[model samples]
Target: MQLNISRGPKATGKTVRLRQTAMKAGIKEKNILIGTSYPDRELEAKVLQLALRGLKVICIDECREEQLAFLRRVKDLICNSVTVHVVVAN
Candidate 1:
């Protein structure tokens, strides 16, 4: 699997970059799952769950350390063909 980690200060257009990458990769919006630690945790978890189901692309924004750990634990769930984009905005 391809893993991309985007790190930068807040409001650096991380989400926009991820979206562009996803589009370039030909992953449909429905097949793309976005997980954000801000605003809501439950919603992020739900989105991550969908990503574990072999979604085309998975983007995690403002990710926490624990969330990174969770990704490691579920790494096997992501297929080799899938690409994961992680955006960490400070």
Candidate 2:
């Protein structure tokens, strides 16, 4: 698993940079999963499931603190060598 972080104030180019990284990684669009970092079980589960299904890149934009904690609890369980995690936050 690889982790890339984009942290800055709002209106910064964090999202753009992460997206560019994902694009440049040469993965297919369907192999790239974009999601939000809120405390939603369905959303969180989808992120993990798709990663397990072989997504090459994962993007979590605007992560909330609680959601970050939740993800941290399960990141190891879902992390794979071929996957890249791009985490964007303020």
Candidate 3:
């Protein structure tokens, strides 16, 4: 399980970098799980997840500094099978 953290200001293309990293890790678009703070976006991610199988490439966007613990928990939960990448826009 690999964990990559991409931190930068808004519009810095963090998400783009994350996608590239996931691809490099051999995870396809169909097997990616993207999570955000927004409820609607999360719903969309859930829908996307339903179409995939096996370990996922979990990308959490807009993560805040204080949410490191939460992110760690998520990482631990799927550490065995997934690669967790976090993107924080400061």
How much does each candidate deviate from the true structure in C-alpha RMSD?
Answer: 3.8, 3.0, 5.0
Encode model 2's per-residue lDDT on 49-78: one tens digit a residue. 767888766766665555555566566777
CA deviation > 4 Å runs, candidate 1: 25-34, 37-54
Is candidate 1 or 3 superior in lDDT?
A: 1
Model 2 global lDDT (CA atoms, 0 to 1): 0.61
lDDT preference between candidates 1 and 2, better one = 1
After the best TM-score superposition of candidate 3, give how far the Cα of residue 14 lies from its true spot, in angstroms.
Answer: 1.4
The clash tally of candidate 3 reads 0
- Tell me model 3's lDDT, rounded to 2 decimals: 0.58
Candidate 3 per-residue lDDT, tens place, 40-83, comes to 44433443353245545666566665554444544444435565
Tens-digit lDDT string for candidate 1 (1-75)? 556778777787887887787778776655445455344446445545656675766656566655555666556
Between the candidate structures 2 and 3, which one is better when assessed by lDDT?
A: 2
TM-score of each: 0.60, 0.68, 0.53
Question: Count of backbone clashes for each model?
Answer: 0, 0, 0
Give lDDT for model 1. Answer: 0.63
Candidate that scores best on lDDT: 1
Sequence-dependent TM-score of model 1 = 0.60
Q: All candidates' lDDT scores?
A: 0.63, 0.61, 0.58
